[model samples]
Target chain A: MIGIDLVQSTAETLMRKAAIEIPDDYLAGLKTAAAAEDGDLSSFVLEAMLENYAAAKEDSRAMCGDTGCPRWYVKMGNEARIDGGPIALEAALRRATASATSSVPLRPNRVHPLWRTDHDNNVGIGAPEIEYGFEPGGDWIDLVTVHKGGLFGTDYRMLFPSDGIQGIKRFFLDSLVAFGKRGLACQPAIIGIGLGGSKDACMVLGKRAACLRVVGDRNPDAKIAELEDELKDLGNNIGMGAMGFVGKSMVIDCNIEVGYCHTGGMQMSVHAFCLSSRRAVARIYGDGRVAYRTDPQWFTDYQRRETVEWPQAQTKSG
Target chain B: MATGPNKIRLSTNPTDDAIAALQIGDIVYLDGTIYTAREGVYMRVIEDRVDLPLDLPAVSAANFHCSPAATQHDDGSFVLGAVTATASFRFSKWIGRWLAASGAKLIIGKGGMSPEDYRDHFVPNGAIYLTTVGYGTGALLGRGVKQVRELHWKKELGLAQAMWVIEVENFGPFIVESDVAGNSLFERENAKIAANLEAAYEGTKPAVLKRFGETDDRKDEMI
Candidate 1:
């Protein structure tokens, strides 16, 4: 049996590291926002992102309570074997989930939709979610865990089949509009677009795309990255200024994830992350050893970046 | 005495009392106040037709609700900033009239002020709009809350209906949005965007032709 304590300790440490790294990306992204003329990434947006960060920090809780369906993607190697066989993965994951919940103080956001009750532990049927894959001839298991805070206000998107290839553009633009209508304006956020998958897979990948983004990073796909850059610039130019306050900086980065579709349908889903941009990508080996491949400080810093301040409570019209 | 407005600056940490005492015009130096609040509260005030408990007789000045933090002060007081809630657009729908009727002088929030309805209703009724720094909740809260007041929502409404009135101090060097004359920055920006887009469209030309021909003409190709 894998030592539950070991699994829990490792998961806790990874989450802590990821939390600390959120703010670094935030500051770097902010500079990008300031540089653009009409960028969607605005100071107002940054401020909002920072606000979420501060709340998460001060409260020391999940950055956003929406903490949607928890999901983890794990790649196991052939040599990997737990003392207890198949149940070992489940046990280790459960321990990891427990550690993350208490250590990160994650909001007890998971629940049974029909029952309308809080799981209180952020776990439910197939929750504290994890997906595992095994390699044929490797000695290490690679674990990538993501706890997405789905802001329905920002994450939900739909693309029509008839709109054709242009539908993709329309879907994105419409998502932006919907997000704005939801009052996500002036929120310096990251956009994640998931393409080609079963309906559920598309949604999952879209959110996962956001999780994969580096605080100061760009998408690897040059074309998609360029589009993200353009969108960021255009969004800031929307004049929704910080917190929609009217200074540049709206969205800092946009991430795109492409998934193979089982069916021949053009489907896209998008998710946005506020400045906190909290996500952890860790490699847990077959030995249950974990290492943060990306400097976790980025997530921490993104959470701590600054926002505009008010000088006083009262004011006179000029 | 310190120069300028009696500014109370909080770092990223602040005490509650400091946050509670916040009044319009007092420069609040804040260090904390994590931003929170979904659309629920604003909508409750806007579309639900429920009388807001947090609604005051008149707000000569007010700022809060972008972020809320629980913080401590050097002097051992608990303060919070960014905890105050105010959404200009949603509130302006109905409370704008209430503000005018109540002789409220200023409304401070993230987005700029609104339409003739607000201007005609409030300006004539004695109100102005101010824009506060959006992300500075932590900095403001660090200064300490000057006061915290809990308002009772109409009893007929559910528990979710209640509003909390938290007064903060030294919260801004905020900008003016709508004045007695009814000017608005949001409107100005939106209009400018239209003009700029129109001009850009008019100036647009075939990029390939412009780039190739502008370059030393390809003599061989032309021949």
Candidate 2:
């Protein structure tokens, strides 16, 4: 069984890593953006961000003062068993979040929506939301922590089948231009677009596409992947770069994720993962072995399967 | 280490001439003292009429719209890790009075206020806005902070809203978003970008269903 102590310790470490380190994929993407950036002010902003990442690592401090809202995505295999059950695992994660809030010296950004009560620990009603997923096999649990900036760069719209791809592009540009001004969205960012899902699910999918996936990874569907590339180019060519200056480096990458939705509606959401796209992941095996990596590897073939039943024939052949 | 032709380092309590000499897009690094004060502090001092905690513009004329990533030990010592600014446009209502009341000469934050604000309030008060670089250069800014002098109203305003008095040297790499004459760097950039928006947005159509209070003007800024 996976030990609770191990879980908490690993979680604490993940929190620190997420706060301080810019993941390799994102760092590489930003470097490319910086190289191509020409706007005088925008270029300076990109260069400063590059240095800030290095400083964060060397000093072991958070890359951003507003460390963003901490949240979790826990995936368990069918046969996985914890030292305690899911409840115990949750307690461990919460404890780790609180401990790391103080130890990492993260700003207490979470508060009651209305009352504005500060736990100062980043824990409260629905704070540090814990989401769950299940895989088909293996006796292991994967823990993913994402610290995404809570404000700006996200929008939802209810589009119809009649609205089509043109509508999608229109709204996409609208969101980018709206938040890209003065760099509120922190552009040269990973722009994630969600199409086809319920209103709430669309938001969730777009957020996951931004935070859970790494740069340079493409959607499995060829048509959707083409759209992603098109959007990326379109965003960059908007004549806006870092801090909304005149340049060609607005989008570092574009990620699109889709889910089956209502026949008449095409719900869409756009989410921008800022320059400091903080995320870290780890997998704990039944043997108490833990492996850590940046990519969440969230969208497996099985996870995206459209068939109602698991296709054992195709799986075994593969 | 980052060098530019427009770079200028000034004291937190800069002279009026020093403020006037700055131009839009000039880079600035501050030395001496600065304090964090945003909506929470503004509301207290402006609306609630709370007595000022420390001498303003005397101890420091720079007002930072920030909340550092920090933790206080039981022994009262503090560990401040990263420092970055929040958006400043939201504080436009209370800013004019805050500047007048506190005699603040430097208003530092992210995504500066509208040019109208600069012309109306900041110009009259002899203040300018300096926008933090990258909007997340927290660690770099943290390195500039030499010490945390004091934290005020922690119990009343909580950690994020409390006033933090900090001393620093070479404390910023902020860009002059607004000038003493009220010219705005952001507005200049926005206007330039707006010239190209029609072409970039070509071939796209607005949504079939429009939301209430939605404006279709491409030039209109959300700030």
Report the number of the highest-lDDT candidate: 2
TM-score of each: 0.58, 0.98
* Range of the 10 consecutive residues with the lowest summed lDDT in candidate 1 chain B: B214-223
Write the residue-wise lDDT of candidate 2 on A1-318 in tens digits. 889999999999999999999999999999998988878888888999999999999999999999999999999987889988999999999999999999998999999999889989899998789999888777889999999984889999999999998999999999999999888998889999989889999999999899888899999999999999999999999999988878888788999999999999999999999988999999999999999999999988877788889887654442
Over A72-183, each residue of candidate 1 has an lDDT whose tens digit, in order, gives: 6665555665556556666676666655654544434455657534434556777766765544444555555565543432443334455444455545544543344313
Global fold similarity of model 1 (TM-score)? 0.58
Model 1, span B77-122: residue lDDT tens: 4333223223455554555545533334445555544566555675
Indicate the DockQ of the complex predicted as candidate 2. Answer: 0.76
**Which portion of correct inter-chain contacts appears in model 1?**
0.04
How do the residues B1-223 of candidate 2 rate in per-residue lDDT, one tens digit apiece? 2355488999999999999999989989999999999999999999999999999879999999998999889999999999999999999999989999999999999999987899989999999999999879999999999999999999888889999999999987899999999999999999999999999999999899999999888787777
In terms of lDDT, the poorest run of 10 residues in model 1 chain A is: A296-305
